[model samples]
Target: MKNIVNKTFELFSELEHCNNDQQKWKIEEMDGIMREMSEDELNSVLSARMLNKICQMIEEKKMSMENAILLLKCIGYCTMLKRIRVYCFNDSLVNKRFKTLIVDEYKKKEKKNEKLLVDFCECYISLSIYFPSGLLSVCVPCLQKVAFQKEENEEAQNEVEMALMALSNVKNSEVKKELSLNEITDIIEYHQEHHNLTHLAYQSAWQFLIFRFNMERSLEEVIVNELHFVREAARELEELRECVDWKRREKKKGEKEMKEVLIIGRWLDVIVHFFLSCQLWNEEFFGLIGGIESAFQKAKGEHRGICKECISSFTNIERNRAVTIEDLLKGRAVDAVVKEFQTQTLNNEMTYECLTFLMRVLRRLKEEKDEMGEEKINTIKKKLFEKMEEEGHEDIAISFYEILHFFKRRYDNGLSLDISDYFVNVRENG
Candidate 1:
């Protein structure tokens, strides 16, 4: 069995020489060996010998770019290679050798193929590397390459997908271990640098790490760090979106490039959503709402039009729903966010979206009537109505009146005349 495995490695080496005859014969021999060895033995032989040979060729500079990539594919397709990747990543010598191979390949390429080279580089960095030192500088060029590359080769694409999956699994395991915020940050930074991964990737990786480590880092720490990461990522994505190449891609596919940008944008949205919802749930992370809101405000200011629109919409929906929940317990009104939402009007098509926000806020206020007290609630309602009137939201005013009437009938009896008259008058005047 050992001899047969040796022969198989020898055959693979010969295939590198472009000798078709030898390749065929070697494959035939490999087939017979596979038939003889049990699954365990096959795995052992592949990990011990076959994988080592591939690494050796890379170390010896005997592997071609094409062959090295093909070898990666072969390994990826093999069940044993998955385990081997984990083991090899843990090994300093093996990991260094892999990095060297990828860097060398990148250096040999001309400018025209640089993007392709960078994809390979990202793949190399993403596979086994982890935190502050994983691949930050390395990822920049690789990201540039991904942006530059007009099309993706199968291996490059597959490698990225696989890398994400592996990181996700690692994160899950780390969460069980209960790692610290700094530790989670390290993992995120590592993935960001090496894989040139997006914020979502970082978030996913962090979530998994938290689960894997089973650490008890405060939710505040988690949210703050995540928001910081997202903010930076969003800025970078915005710049990338402005690039001529990226714009060209956008024109070609409308939102294809935008979708890629959204990879980061969506994570930012999640952080905002989580923080606001946390406020209502009375989660410890609620404290970060101020910071999160500031971040969103800055983001909205810096990026007007579509980017601002999407994020603002997200904030509106989250804040409205958050304020309504009874169990989550609302804090002091975020006058700034409310003012911002009111100031940003939508077209007729977006009226419903706007209505949704108003409805959520009203519903929450009604549900928590006892906690908020009649006097404070009425003050808030009056303020909201005045703001709506100022903004010419007659429709909103009318809807509020209807809602007030319903509540007045159900809870306050006919004594809710003030609310009913205000809305009814607004409807009539409009």
Candidate 2:
């Protein structure tokens, strides 16, 4: 720890006096040191003084492509740590200078340094989380151009992925005011039709578009647009269904597949938020209810929770609505929720999500008592109560009580609950 601090100080001093070539070498050394440090060590080393110097190095005009990439990497690492990010954000001069550098780079003619472009996108993304206003204008246009380039190579695909991600992080209303609804439609259309795009890139593209849609459009406008959001969401879910091997019911095996599954899970999560906010409960327009139900039956891990939540939201239609609940209940949705609740250990954020999903199902079953047989409903109630009684789930059961009672007393079931209970549980257990 002492050695890392001393080394950081020495590098800081060397960077101030070094020429361009020596600065490049020292920047590489700094990147290596940062990469090797644990999160604690990195946090400790990124004092306000150290962070300021790093930002200064990034603003250097004569930096080599290699050194630029290295410095971006260093800045990217700094932006990830909350303390360092706060330091960067609070220092207004440093923040504006860094943003100027990024925007100016984006304004230049397309460069040959593909790696530097990718690194810039990634660094901009990390910084945008804390400095969205400063970074969004350059990031949105720069990333959008790359995302639409549709280049058919891995590096291009990687560029598109980072671009999509950088765009997704942006929330500045200044940029949003300039966005055309057609642009949002174009990206979603691209995602739906482009079969060759990598899963990461595909997911990233929709995530950004979805953010823009949810923020810019009201529920009424979403309907007036001819249910574009619902249709596209359904299309993505159907594609996800085709991608999965349903009969196997096997966990997606490899790091790559696991990551894909998790991405799909997160994608479903954002879709859930979109649907809930829009309150687009018409199963007829919200097509592909069956696909969501079928996939939840076989989904494992975090995927299961989101799938179940999707099922919960889709079925949670108003009684007077034109569509019958029976239309969405293609199969035993309650059974999947109960089985997941019974089998899921009292760990993971998924447990809380699944539990909230279960609460919704329980309320729905009680309302339309005829939809599910009394026997099956009682069976589900029994399994849920039994699981809650288990020693490990006591905390969850306690947190579950208020929402459970709210749904029963004819209150607004849409009232939010603290979803952090599971994380708190994990910390205590850890």
Q: How many steric clashes between backbone atoms does each model show?
A: 27, 0
Question: Which pairs clash (backbone N, Cα, C closer than 3 Å) in model 2?
Answer: none
Residues forming the 10-long window of minimal summed lDDT in candidate 1: 421-430
Q: Candidate 2's residue-wise lDDT over 1-430, tens digit each? A: 4576568667767775677889878877876666545446666765556555555655665444456555655655433321133344445444555565666666678674444445565665645445455466555655676677667788877666656655555533445546534554566566556654666566666556555655665533544255465555566666665565544434334434444445556566555545444543444542545545556765655344445565555444323243333443443443454455555443434444456554454455465556767665565455544544553445645555555434434443453354332221111111
In model 2, which range of ten residues has the least summed lDDT? 421-430
TM-scores of all candidate predictions against the true structure: 0.37, 0.58
Top-lDDT candidate index: 2
Regions of candidate 2 where Cα sits further than 4 Å from its true position: 1-65, 68-96, 103-122, 130-135, 171-174, 191-196, 218-253, 281-328, 344-355, 364-430
RMSD of 1: 16.4
Under the 3 Å rule for N, CA and C atoms, how many clashes does model 1 have? 27
lDDT of 1 by residue, 95-148 (tens): 565566556655574554654555455444444434223333344334432332
